[model samples]
Target chain A: MSDKTSRRTPGPVYVGLDMGSSRSKVVVIDEAGKLLGHAVKKSGTDFSRTAKACLDSALEMAGAEFDDIAGAMSTGYGRSNVGFVTEESKTEIGCLAKGGYHHFPEAITIIDIGGQDNKIIKLDAAGHRLNFKMNRKCAAGTGAFLEEMSARLDVSLEEMNHLARDAREMIKLGSYCTVFSATEVLESIRNGKNVNDIVKGIFYSMIRRVLEMDSLTERVVMTGGVVAHNAYLVEMVDEMIGRPVLLAEYPQLMGAVGAALYARDENQSAGATTAQASSKGE
Target chain B: MAAGKSTTRKKIQATDLMNQVMSDYFYHLNEAATSGKQKVAWCTSVGPAELLRALGFAVHFPENHAAMLGATRMSTELIPEANSAGYSPDICSYLTADIGAWMKNITPLSKAYPGIESVPKPDVLVYNTNQCRDVQDWFSWYSKELGVPAIGISSPKNVVEVTEGHIDDVARQIEALIPTLEAISGNKLDMQRLRETVTLSRECSELWKKVLETATATPAPLTFFDGTIHMGPAVCLRGTQEAIDYYRVLLAELQGRVEAGVAAVDDESLRIYWEGMPVWGRLRQNSDLFAGLRTSVLASTYCSSWIFPSFDADNPIRSMAKAYLELFIVRSDAYKERYIKGMLEKYRIDGIIYHDAKTCPYNSNSRYGLPQRVEADTGIPCLVLSGDLNDLRCVSDEQTKTNIEAFVEQLQERQ
Candidate 1:
C-alpha cells in the first residue's frame, strides 16, 4: 500500500510535482478532474525538499491535507530526486505532450524552450508522439543563454523582453556560442548600436537557433517558463514561423498539470480494479 | 557531474570474460617478439582478419585501441598530441587518438594494467576502404613511420549491389597480399589453411549473429555497451579458433541468462536500438542514464558490423570480398534504412538512438534526415544524440541526460 492508503481520505485528489532545473511546481486536482490548487517554488540544491514544500503549499491552497491526495506523479529534471510520487514518473517530454494535447486535440508540435535545452516534439492527431528533437549540446537558444545575455547587458531579464519592443532597427547577432555571442553583443554596444536593438537581435537569434533544430508541423504549441515569462519571444516565434503559436494554459505549469492528469488516470484505474475485484467476490 | 549514484543493476557475466580475453589478447601481442613465431599486422576494423590469421599473424586493430583509449578517459590528453601534428581536430578521432597515443607514449590501459603496451608495433599494415577513407590514410602514415610495406583494398562505393566483378577486384588484391605477408612471416600460404581459417571466421560470424539475435528477447539479457566490449575478439581474432571459442562461451552464458529471466538492465521497461559508434569516453555516463530509466539499449549496428550472413568457406577470397563489401555502412541511405527497419522488427525495438559523432563525417553524414524517414516508415520514434566517439569535450553530459529523458518520455507516450 502507498502513503495514500495509510492516510486514506474520501476527498479523492491527485497531485503533481514538477522538479525542474530552475523551479519546482506542484498542482492539485479534485475528484471532478478540475484544478483545485497549484504552487511554484525555486529548486535549490535539495530538490526533494523543494518538491515537498511545493506539494505542501499546493495541498494547503486546495484546502486539503496530504491525506486527500489519492495519487501523485512527478516530472522534470529533478523527478527522480523526489520520494512520494505514487506512479513511475514521466519525463518532461511526455508531460508536455499530454498537456499540449489536453488543451488542443489536434496534431501538434511542441517547442518547449527550457532553462538549459530546447525540445521539438511532434504529436499525431490522437496525441501519440510521432517524433522529437533536442538541441545538440548547446545552450545558445535556451533561457540560460538569455540570462547570461541579460547579465552582460546589465539589464534585468524581465526588462530585456520589453526592451526588444522599443527597437527601431534589429541588429542580428551571428555566433551560436554563448561566450562568442556575449562578445558580439558587447561589440555591438561599442559600435554605437542602441541597446534595445541589440536586445531585439538577441531574441531574434535565439528564436533562429531553435528554428534550426528541427522543422515544425502546422500546429505548434509552445511551453516552458521561458515563454511563460517572455511574451515577446512568443510573438517573435509567431512571426518567424509565420504561424500563430498556441500556448498551454499556465504554460510554466503545463508539465505539472500533465503529471496531475497522469496521477488522476492511475487513481481512477486503481479504483476500477478494486471495484472489479469486489464485484467478483460478490 | 550528475550525482554518481551507485546502481543496484547486476553486471553481465560475459563482460568480465570479455575483459579477460581482451587483456590476454593485448598481452600476447606485446610478447609477440619474445614468442618468435607470431607476426603482428596492423589492420582496419573491417579488414580481412581471416587472411592475416591464415598466415599466422596476430592482427591488431588500431580503431579498437583508440576506442579503449576513449573508454579509459585518456583521449583528452592524446587527441591534442595528434592535433599538434598535421592532423586537424576535425579528422576522424580514431586516427587522431591512435596517432596521438603513439606520439605521447601514454595509454590509460598501460597506466592501469601492468606488463601491457597499449598497442603492439606492426610488422605489416593492411588498409581497406570498405568503411571509410580514414583507415587508408591512417594505415599509410603508420606504414611510413614503421618502415613496413602497406597492402591496400578499395571497394566500390555507392553501388546498390556488390557484383562478382567487385568481388573479383577485391579478391585480386587479397591474392596480391599473399606475397607480402608470406615474405614477412617466412611461410607459404596453404589453400587448406586459408579454407580452415575462413570456416572458423564463418562460425564466429554466425555465433555473433546469434548473440545479437538473443537481445530480441524482452528485457534483453545483453546491451549494446556489453556488445561494444564483447566485439573485441570478433574484430581482433575473428579467423582464429580462440575467437570461436570465446563466442561459444559467451553465447551459452547469455542463453542461460535469458532462461533465468535476467536482464542487462535490471528493470527493462523500454527496448531501444543504438545506431553509430558509442561515445566511448562517456559510455558509463550514457549507460547509467538508460539504466536509470529502465531502458535497455539492446542492440546496435556498431556491434553487429562483424556479422556476415554470407560467409562461404568453399570460395574463400570471393566470399570474403563479398562479406566485406556488402556492409550496410558502405551502402546508400535507402539500403541502410531498410536494414535498420529489419533490425527494428527483429529486436522488437521501441525506438532508435542515433549517436551523431561530431568528428566522424563519413558515419554521421546521412544522419540529419534519418529520423524523419525512419519515423515515417516504421512509426517508431528516433532520437539523434550529438557526441564524439573519442573527443570528450564535444558532448555535454547534462544536455545528453536531458535529451535521453525526453526521448524516454516520447517512448512512454507512444506505449
Candidate 2:
C-alpha cells in the first residue's frame, strides 16, 4: 500500500486506545468518521506498553505509520496510562454511550460486561447520556465471574459459552456472589446436573445483573469483550429483555471507536482555533 | 535545581483556619480532664449539645471522632478489634471503629493532640434518635461499659409537618435531661446561659448555611470535600462562641475567593450535587478526580443537614426540638425528594452523585429508587456510587472515577 498523505489533502487521522482490564484495543479512524483499521490484544501487566503495541498493530493494519496520526484519545481501565493521548481521556461508560449512540443515534440502553465490572448506560433521543449504573464493588455478573465458573467446571472460557448455548435446560443460580456461585456450581455437579446447564445458569445470572442495573429503553445495544466472543450471551439478553439487541460492528473495539471520535472532535476544534488565529492576523 | 511545581487549582485558605480551630478544640478536650474544672459529656451529632454547654460540661461527639478516624484511614485498621468483639462486620462502621478503638486502645486524635491517649471519658452519655437508632444503641453500649447513666431523645418519624405537639414531645425529653445533667455535672442549668447558648447555635447554623450557599457562584468557591472537613466545627463546637467565631472567619475567606473569581475546581464546566455521606478516606482523591474532569460538586445534602431554619431563641427547648427533628436524614422520602429538587434548582445542578454507603443503612436506603425519581422529575441525570463513608473495602476508585467522568460527559452532551 502506498502512502496517500502527500498526494491527498493530508486529511487528519485519529487513533483511539482502550486499555481494558482483560484486554486492550485500538482503532484508527479517518476524517470522514470511517474505521480505517483496528487491533486487539490481551492487556498484560504493563498497560502503557500494551497500549502502544495495540496502536502499532492497528496502524500497521491500516497501512499507515505513527506520523500519519493527527490526534489520539484513550479510554477504559488504563485510560490515564496511555502516553499518546494528547487530550483528556473519557470514561468507559461515556465511551460506551458514544459508541452505542453512534450506531443507533436514538434513545438506547447499553449493557457492557467487562472483566471486573458491568455498566448500563441510558441515552436520550438525541444520543445524550441520561444516566448510567455500574456494578463495581462485586465480581458477580461480570466477565471475571464467568471465567471463574469456567475454571470451576474445568473448561475454557470460550468453551463454556459454546456449551451454554447448546444446553437444553438452564440452571438458575440464586447467589449474586462469585464465591457462593462457584460453590453452587459444585453442588449442581454433585446433584448430577449437566455442565452445559450450569454454564447457562452463569450466563443467566450475568444477564439478570445487567438487566437489573437500570430500566431499559426501546433501543438496546450490547457491547464489550464478553459479548464480542460469546454471541450466545446477547441471545440470552435479547430473550430476557424481550427485544432484539443491537450489537456494535466491532463489539470489543467500541470503546476505542468512541475514543477515536472524541479525538477527531478535539482535532477539529484545534484546527478551528488555528484557523481563527490566522484569520485574525489577516 | 528546578524547584517549585506549577499548580492551577486554588486551595481553600480557610483550611488553615479550620485545622487551627479543630486542633485547639481537641487540645482543650485533652486537658478537660486534667484541668479538673469541667466534666466531659459524650453527645451525638444531632443531640442536645446546647443544653450540655449550658450545664457547664465540655462536650465531644463520637460521630466526629469516627469521621476523623474515617478521614485518617484508621477505621479499617481498628475494625478487626470490633469484629473480634463479636460485632458483625455489617454493623455501622462508626460503631465498629469507635468500639474497636476502645478495644485496641488506639486514638488517631492523640497523634495530633499530644498526651491524649483516648477520647475523654464521659460523665454522662446523651443521644437523640433523630439521625438514626444506632446513636442510641451505640451510646447505651458505651454507657454500660463505663457504668454511667445515659439519656436519649426520640423524634417522631414520617411527619409531613413538624407540629407543636411534635416539638413538645422532643422538648419534654430534653427538659427531663436537665436534672440528670445538673446532678452529674454538679452545676445548675442556668436559664440565661441556656438561652444564650441556643442563640449562639442558631447564629452558627445560619453562618454555616451562608458558607454553603457561597457555592452557588459560578465555578463554586467551595467543593463538597471542603464542606465535609469544615463540618467539624458545626458537629463538635456548634454551641460555643469559638465555633461562631470560626465560621465567621471561614465565611469571610469563602466570600473573598468568590469575589476574586477563585474556584474550588479550576475551569469548572459542570456543577453537580452529592446526595450522601462522603467516602471519608478518599475525599481528597474523589474531589481531585472531579476537579480533574472540570466538574464541581458544589453542594450536598450531608453538609446542608446542619442548616437549621426553624430555630426560635425565645423558646429554646421547643425550638431545639423543632430544629433537630427536621434534620434531612430524619424526614420522609417525599420531603427529601422535594428538598433535593429545591437544592438542584437553587444550585443549578447538572447531575447528582448518590453515594450508597454500605454500612449506613439509614442514609443509604433512600438512594435506591430516589435517583430515578430525581432524574424523571428534574430532568437531571443521577449516578449511584456504591461506597462507604469509613470502610475503604466497599469503595472502588476506578469505578467511581469512571461513573463521575461519564456523568460529566453526559452534562456536556446536554450543553
Candidate 3:
C-alpha cells in the first residue's frame, strides 16, 4: 500500500501466503532464495472470516511478526486477497510452474495433486513449460480423494501411505475420484484383497494417470498439502514412475514460497526507488 | 404474444377433462374404422403433423391434439378421473391428464366432433421424443393400449462430444432393428426404404449441422430455435422417406440464404456452447433470445448427439442394441470427455451455457467444475444456466434473459 520505496533492514524477510480450498499455508523466505520459516493451518476459506484465524496461527508458529515482513506474496485458491502487496495474482498453473522450477532446477514435469483436481504439467527439458493436462474435470486423483478413500478403508493417513508403499502387486483401481475409487476400494475389499494393497493400487492408479498426462515427463517433482502427510505417495510415485521424486520440504508451502519471492522482489525495488528519489532531492 | 399467452392460459388444474375428451374422440374414431384403423401415426412433440402428412401418413400427436381441443380449459370438470387415476400432485399435470384421457373412451368433447366417428383410427403409432424423453414411455403405453407394437424413433442423448464411431454404432443398431420391425409390424423393411431413411436422416442431419456451422459466419443466417423445431421431422421419422424430403427443402432454403450471405444473427460477435440437457419446454423461447442478442450458439453438447449418431453403413445390423446403449449419456464419463472436447474444437465454442436440467441428473454431472475446465481448455467463459431440462416452472424467462444478455455482452467485448 506504500508508494514510498524505503530500504529494508538486514533482517527483513518476505512471506508467501496461500489459502487452498482445504487448508492454508505460509512461508518466509529471505534474500538469496533461502527459506527462513514455514507453517500451515487446517482451515476452510469462509471469506467472511477473512482468514484471520489461519493467519494468526501461521504467524505464531513462524515467530514472524507483521512488521518484520517487508512484503508478502500470496497465491493458491485465495491468492487474490492475501493482502501482502498490490501485485496482481498469477494463475494456479503459473504459481505451480514457478514452484516446480524453484524446487527442482532441472525439473521438466510438475505433478500437483489437490483435493478436487489433478494437474500434470509438462515442461521441455530446458524447463520452458511446454504443455499441461488435467483430469476428467473432477476432484479425483487429488489428495482430498485419497483422504476420503483412507476414511472408507478405516485406515489412518500415515497407514494408508505406508501400506501403499509396502504393496508388491498393484490392482487396477477404477479411477482416482472419490466417488469411483471408494467403490472400487470397496469392491477390492469384497474380493478379499488386503486393504493396504487396495490402497496401494489406488496410489499407483493415480500415479499412472498423472504419468499418462505427462507422457513426456522427465524428472517429475510433486507439490501439495498431501505430499508431506502421505509419505507413501512419494515412495509409490517413485516406484510407479521408476524414479525418485523430490518432495517440497514443505510441500504445501510452494505457493507460499512463490508469493514470498514476489513480495521480496517488490520490497527491494520499492526501497531502492525511495533511496534514489531522496538522494536526488538532497 | 397474446394469442400464445391466452392459448397457454388454460386450466392450471390436474383433472381428466382433456384426457376424457381425447379418449372419447379416439373411441368413436376407433368405432368408425371399418378398415381397421388404417395408416395410424404417432407424433413426438406438441406441434402440427404437417411434416408427417407431407411425408404421407395419417398423422396424430396425442399431446398436440389434446392441447388443441382446449379440454385443459375445463380440467376441474374431470376431477373424478384425475383422482381415480392416482395422478396426484407430484407428477406433471399434463401427463396425468393425457394418460387419464387415454385410459377412458368417453368425453364431453367427443360429442363436439360429431363426424369424428367417421374418421378412421390410427393404425401405426409414430412416437418421437427428440424434444422430450417422456414421449418414449407415453407412446409405449399407448402401443400397449392399441395392442400394436408402435414404431418409436428416439434421438441420441446430448453430451459434450459425439464421434464417428458413435455414428457408425447407432447406424448398426438401427440396421439391426429391421428384423425386429418385421416381427413387430409384420412388415419387412426393404433395404431401399432403410437406405432412403438413412440417406434422408443424414442429409437432414448434415443440413442441420451446416446450419449450426454457419452460425460461425458473421451475421449468422439462421437462428437456433428454428433448427430446434425444424429438426423435429428428421428425428421422429428417421426410417421414412418424408423426413429426408422435409429437411431437403429446409436445407435448400438455408443454403440459398448462406449463398447470398445472410446472417442468422446479423453482426454476430458473441458465441456460446450449450452445456447439459436442453429445456424442451422452453427450447424455442431460449434459442430466440440468443438470436435476438446476436449471440449464436456455435455448438451445444445437446445438439452434438446427432454429430456422431449414425452407425457403420456396412454390417449395420449386428450391433444395434449396443449402439443404443453406447449413446454418450449411457456410456462412461471417458466418452463424455471425448464428446465435449470434440464440440469445443469443431464449433470453436467461446463459452458454455450449462443448462442444468432439473429432471435429468445424467446430463448435469460434475457441472460445478465444468466452467473451470472449459475456461482453462478452450479459454471460453462459462455460466451455469439454472433451469430444468423440461419443466417450465423451473424456467424463469426474465432471469434467464437477463443473464444471457450480460453473458453475450461480456463475450462479445472479450472477442
Q: Which candidate is the best by TM-score?
A: 2
Error of 2 at B407 (Å): 1.1
In the range B179-216, model 1's lDDT, one tens digit per residue, is 98899988798888889989988999999988888898
Say which prediction, candidate 2 or candidate 3, comes out ahead on lDDT.
Answer: 2
User: Compared with the true structure, what per-residue lDDT tens digits does model 3 show for residues A1-282?
Assistant: 122224444367676666676777766666766775565766564631444555554444445566776776665566555543334444455556666777777756778776555666655544444444445434566777777877888988778777876787877776655687788888888889977678878777666666665364577778886776777778877876688887777777776776676677767898899999999995
Residue A268, candidate 2: alpha-carbon lDDT? 93
Residue A176 in candidate 2, Cα distance off native in Å: 0.7
DockQ of 3: 0.02
lDDT of 2 by residue, A1-282 (tens): 222223332356788888899999998888877887788988999998888888877777676678889888888888878865443587778777777887778898888888878888888888777778888588888888988998899999879778989999999999888999999999999999999898899899888877877778778888888999899988988888788999977788888888888888888999999999999995
- Cα lDDT tens digits, model 2, B163-280, are 7888889999999999889999999988888889999999999999999999999868999988998988988888888888989999999999889998888887889899888899
* Candidate 1 residue-wise lDDT, A1-282, digit = tens: 112323223387888788888889898887765677788888989998898888887777776788777888888878878776553577777777777888888999999888877888888999888777778778899989999999999999899878998889899988999999999999998898999999999999999999998888769999888899889989999998898999966788888888888888877898899999999995
TM-score of 3: 0.48
> In candidate 2, which residue ranges exceed 4 Å CA deviation?
A1-12, A84-88, B1-11, B365-368
**Each model's DockQ score:** 0.34, 0.49, 0.02
